[model samples]
Target: MTKKQPKSDATRRRNRVDSSTRQPKPPKSDPNNFHGSNNHHFLAIIAVVFVVSSAISAFLYRRINHPSLPPSFAHQRGLVKEDVTFQEILTENSRVSENVTQRHFTNPVLAYITPWNSAGYDLAKRFCPKFTHLSPVWYDLKSQGTKLVLEGRHNADTGWMSELRLRGNAQILPRVVLEAVPKDLLRSKKQRDKAIDLLITECKDIGYDGIVLESWSRWAAHGVLHDASLRKLALQFVKQLGDSLHNVRSQRNGQPLQLVYVIGPPYSESEKLQAHDFGPEDLRTLSDSVDGFSLMTYDYSSSYSPGPNAPLTWVHSTIKLLVGEGGKSLANKIFVGINFYGNDYVVAEGGGARAITGRDYLSLVDQYKPTMRWQKDFAEHFFVYSDDQHHEHAVFYPTLMSIAERLKEARSWGAGISIWEIGQGLDYFFDLL
Candidate 1:
């Protein structure tokens, strides 16, 4: 009360700031404080994450849409790593054909018809004009001797004649599968010669355009030994058959009957997972003995597992082997197999898968509307989904894009292509042709 000594101006201001009722002091603002810096830092971090995520999503989209982006052809046998590109293949395809009238595909498009199935007939009627050759399964070698026997009713019926007529001048090369024959009979030169003669006579009598000799060890009960025998006899049969068939003009058209040999995958001798009798030497021999060779590149992973019908990676590997110096000479005459079907499995791991045609697969996709994704590593499309009971299913198949990549590979190597079973393909499948 000592008359609250007259306060100084500075003392009055300090008192005002300290007093709660004094104008409610304005808050302090510091640009370098912890809360302000922390907020700015968080905003900066968020911006960086957003940019990174957007970039990753874009990259994945590009990869999935265009799976056939050319890889380093460095290890691929035929092309120079730097020179080969997808653009180059497209250009080659567009190059003018020798027949100035035609600028279409240069390679032969062979369609395989399983005569036992009605679908084959439908495929023949629908796609006959599009194919370069129609290979109808007609004959199978007998177990008793190297005898050619009719496979099914279609072989003996006049229906094949009408079907052949629908081919629009396409070659009618009946496929003669050497599957059920005894290895011993095939090994015996006398029996092999008899069989070759019989095949030629039957082909001439039947008015077929040509013949395709298919040898599969799995089709026969014999294991490695049987494969070995067939492998040895394959060259003999091919050489004899080619010499005999080509020398004898077809009674119908007076043209040299063409001969083709369907071989197993071009695996190196070391990898013997499947029973294979043919080796590099056998391949070369067969190549020498036939008008051309068709490598069975499909069925790499069939109903055995939930996997791609034909993985592009493996197809590339097979291409490398065939186009390599070892099999280079056979490149032009080679025809790689393509599957028009897929495999559907109960699980992605171990289970018996069922064959699904391209058409059937599309219908299933529509029905289930499952989650589908492009498998980048394999260069194939696969999907996973849960059923009503929550049972997961996986389906893998080829799309037009994937098949285009394969065709590119074949074109790069100057090889032809053949569909495993024409009936399984979707109608649009022929559109690519």
Candidate 2:
């Protein structure tokens, strides 16, 4: 009915406007909306990265802070779940009290370590801080044709030395046994010079701090000490070697090389001065030439006697004879030897004694359960046990008390202590040191 009349322009325009208003229009794209979606994606990425980074950081921290023992060391120690005794001992002794004060020694605390026992290697590393000098019984000076040869270079462990240095700044003075003929070496100045040069070269190349010359015993065995002239030559050779070593500077710290002389103790108080044994006079002669005099004060009783390894009286007398009266200054350079091994002797005809380690002692205690006796006079521990064969055996070993008493005596004299070996003793024995 409305279309019947003529349509006006305003009406047409109004209809068109209504149609346009009713039609759906495409929306405009908002930059802010796109930015919000991108932000959410970025946040999700950041969360994932943070989780991964945290895990990595945690792993690294554990590795650096709480490092486990090297697999090789564990293997060398024969560490297994079955060794309950060893494991228990390790667990008990390994935990050091942070509050406990470390023992300080007036003189150098020297320890001898051998390669035959893996225990020595482990103990040396664990107790690196306890020693001022570590003497590895490694090198041997032997006669090779016209030239002097230094053997046992292959036994030098650079990695172990580095680790020892890192743990504690202990000087690495390897024990050098003199296997060369005394007549050939001490008699000829040329040979002596060659030997000194060889030793110096080895110290420089292997980064050794010094050498522990063990020739007095060998010289005594070869009868060099019996001859007064030869003995004088031997002394001169030692002095020369020491002077040369002291003159040369170490590549590691530029410090002069130290020379330690190993000397044997007198057999008895009434022992005559036959020049066969290194005595107190030798100490005085070598006080300036050597850094320290490692006196072998152990082995007072041998396998034949089956007595204490070192009697307190004997040790006291030995120190007294060597240091003399008011000899505090000389005592400072003396490193009295302490035995860590024991002798197990069979109390029967044709029976002999055998050396044993702390582990062996423990096994004996477990199996035999013998009556362990502490001899106050000798300051040692001894026990008699019957094996499965019904054969009686006497074992004489150093107890913690004995070690402590010996240490006290040495300290009173202002003398340093030298452990004959670290491997043969119990884990707790080191506590005395």
Cα RMSD for candidates in order: 25.6, 36.3
Tens digit per residue, CA lDDT, model 2, 14-66: 22212122111122222122122123432233234233322234233333443
Off by over 4 Å in 2: 1-101, 104-106, 268-271
Scored by lDDT, model 2 comes in at: 0.67
233 in model 1: Cα distance from truth in Å? 3.8
Clashing pairs in 2: none
Candidate 2 accuracy as TM-score: 0.76
The deviation in Å at residue 245 for candidate 1 is 0.9
Rate residue 427 of model 2 by lDDT.
70
- Give candidate 1's error at residue 259 in angstroms: 1.5
Cα misplacement distance, residue 134 of candidate 2 (Å): 0.1
